[model samples]
Target: MTDLRVGIGSLKLKNPVMTASGTAGYGAELAEFFDPSLLGALVMKGISLEPWQGNPPPRITETPCGMINSIGLQNVGLEMFLREKLPFARQWDVPVIANILGTSADEYVRLAAELDGAGVEGIELNVSCPNIKKGGISFGRDMAVFARLVGAVRKTVKSAALIVKLTPDAPVAEFARAAEESGADAVSLINSIPAMAIDVNTRRPLVKNVIGGLSGPAVKPIAVRMVYQASRAVRVPVIGMGGITEGRDAVEFMLAGAHAVAVGTAIFSDPMAPLKILDGIRAYMENHGIKRVSAITGSVRT
Candidate 1:
């Protein structure tokens, strides 16, 4: 029999496929396509203490092999999430990981503590959000600030598994190490890269924000590289994401040192992408004569 389980600290998932936070839209959104319980885990969209209206329209724009979005992390505030969103997710048997974002350390700590107390299986800190108290520098860019915030959340979070989703702007190895040292149970990497597109006809930026994060097939190679770097740097599991569109893409990530992979952009084009990718992983394992999916992690040739 094939074994597909993967563990991140004390949290052991039935498989390794997860929905990228922002794209999954609070977990319940995917229930229409399939049972969310079938997934290894459901990582819901980014959540904030107060409602984030997100950026203005023209938020999403397409590029050659991907799209750019300055969606501005729009989400329903914490109040509604606990009142409505989480109860629906609890109906499913799969692990639910809350992706929390904040403008300062206090907000993150409060969110993490609340989610942990709520009995969610996991808490992922989306450090890509800027530190409003520090002149808007993204928490992931500055190691000192980043580690301090992660540590504070760790102290506040007592039960749920903690993960740090890293930004692509810095050296992933150093950042991953810092998260692991500060008590992260796992680390997810390759948050969208900063990119922009221009319209020659109107001379307007393709995305309303002027600059948006690029994601999809175009970022796969970079995601792979960073996944390998981070995995090699830490003992904790690494969840890789970027441009994963198929099962083969997930295999590429697993071989590159990712213990798990998340599907994001493809979800926009195909709501069933996550299950398809998960199926692809099983096929690859059988073809390779591999019975344990965990063996695929960090098996890349140096």
Candidate 2:
């Protein structure tokens, strides 16, 4: 058997494969396709301080080689997740990571502390939400704002390993280093690129939101470049994600210095995508005489 285990700060994974938040729903629905425990970790959908109904209809549209979605971070409030969602995930042996977003810094801190206290193995901050008090600037887009939030959340989250999901709107290296300095144990990158699709006939936007995050194979190279830049900038682990669809795609990220990789938009097309990608990775390892998965990280030749 291959030694696929890897560690992200204090969190350990049986393999380097995880479910990207938002794509995997919660743990329960995932079981219908494959065993949830088989994954390195289950990153549940993003949760907020309050229940958000999300955007209006026609919130998603397919683009060439990818898709754009303006789902608007809709999720069950933190209360229900604690009451019903977390318990079901705890049933599995795999680690559970919570993807959290909030309108204000205090809300982020509280969400981190609550989920950390509730025994989540990891907490991934989704900092793409606009900061209401900060004149609508995204927390991840402003250096000082991003650092302050991460630093504050770090103070309260004592148990769970902190992971910041970096927004592509900022300089990759600087933001990633800031997260590491602010006490983030790891960083994940290339959260869907901002994009739009237009219906030329009607002269209208395909998605009602006018613009949405573009995800899928279209963003892989950018993801790889960012991951490469980030991993070199910070000593902490870097989790690379963008347009990973096959085993080779995951392999590219791993080579680009991602300690682990997450499957996102690919899940919409193939429910078995993660497992299949894992199999592909295993085959690549065996063929290359690589005895351990960790050996693939950062071994890319210049």
Candidate 3:
């Protein structure tokens, strides 16, 4: 057997395969399919200081080789998640990672502080959400704004590891370095490329938000390039995601310097995609005579 375990700061994973937040829900629904603990880590959907109803109807649209979604960070409020969901997640042996977002720096601080010591392995800051306080600008698009948000959360949270999830709209390496400078433990990248789709007959957009985050195989190559760049730019671990539906794809990400990989849109097609990816990774390692999964991270030959 091959060694599949890896670490992100103080958080350890049985393997480098994790489920993307918002795709796997809070882990209850996925628990019905398999043991949620079997995954390296279970990243829950994005949570906020308050409940979000999300965008209007037609929030998701299927595109070629991928899909676009404008879920608008809809999730149960933090208090309710602590009251109801955290207990259930504690039952599993896997580490639970909270995916959090906020419209303001204060809100982000409050959310991180609440999740601190809340039995979670870490917190992934979903920076793709629009900052309503700043005239509807994305927090991740600006390096200064991104660093400020991360710094606020860093001061508030003491126990859980901080993982900043970056948007593809900006240079990911710059954002990753900014997160590190602000005390982030690790960074996850290629959240989703901003994109849009339209209906020719009505001459209107298919998605209600008009523009949404795109994810799937279409973004995999771009994700790989970003992961490689960001990993080189920072000493922290990089969790790569975007269109990873097979084991070979996951291995490609690791080669690009991702310490771990997350499955997002692929789950919409196959609930057991993460497990399949894990199995494939193990097989690839065995075939290549590789022992530790970490050995391949950033081993890409240019």
Candidate 4:
């Protein structure tokens, strides 16, 4: 029998396929497509210390083989998530990981502490967000700032597994290592890369925010490479994302050194993408004569 179970620190998942944050809004949004329990975990939309209205309209724009968005981490505050989303999430057999974003150490600590006791299986710290307290620079872009942020979050979060979601602006190896060293249970990498698009006809920006994060097939190679670097740099498990649309993509990540993978923009096109990826992974394992999914990690050759 094939074994698909995987782990990130003490957090054990039935399989390695999880929905990326923002793509899977609290799980309920995708219920029509597949049972939430079928997934290893669900990373809901980014939740902040307080509610966010998100950026202005034209937030999403299509690019060749990908898309760009500056959704501005829009989400209900932690309180609403607990009052509304948590109850529904508790019914799912799969682990629920809250993706929390903050602009400062105080906000990070507060959100982490709240989610730690909110019955979530894990907390994914989105350190890539703009820090309002620091002139809007991303915390993950600087090693020193990243380390201090993680250290603060680590001190506040007690029981929930800490998974640091890294930004692509910095060296993933160093950033991931810093997270692991600062008490992260695991690290996920290759958050959307900074990009922009324009309307030549209208002479306006394609997305409302002028600049947005690029995601989809165009980012796959970079994400895979970063996953390899981060995995090699740290002892903790590495969760890879970016431009994953099918099972083959997931397999590529696993072979590149990712212990687990997340599906994001692909979800917008096919709600069943995660399920299909799961099946594809199993088929790939069988074809390779590998019984356990873990065997695929770091199996890539130069």
Listed per candidate, the RMSD to the true structure in angstroms reads: 0.7, 0.6, 0.9, 0.8
Q: What is the Cα-based lDDT of residue 221 in candidate 2?
A: 88
Q: What TM-score, over all chains together, does every model reach?
A: 0.99, 0.99, 0.98, 0.99
lDDT tens per residue, model 1, 32-61: 889998899999888999999999989999
Ranking by lDDT: 2, 1, 4, 3
- Model 2 Cα lDDT, one tens digit per residue, 67-94: 9999999999999999999998888889
Q: Give the Cα lDDT of each candidate.
A: 0.94, 0.94, 0.92, 0.92
Instruction: Name the runs in model 1 displaced over 4 angstroms.
Output: none
lDDT of 3 by residue, 87-205 (tens): 88998999899999888888888889889867588999988777888887889998888899999899988989899998989988899999999999999988888899999999889
Clashes of 4: 1
Model 4: per-residue lDDT, tens digit, 199-250? Answer: 9999999998999999999999999999999999999999999999988999
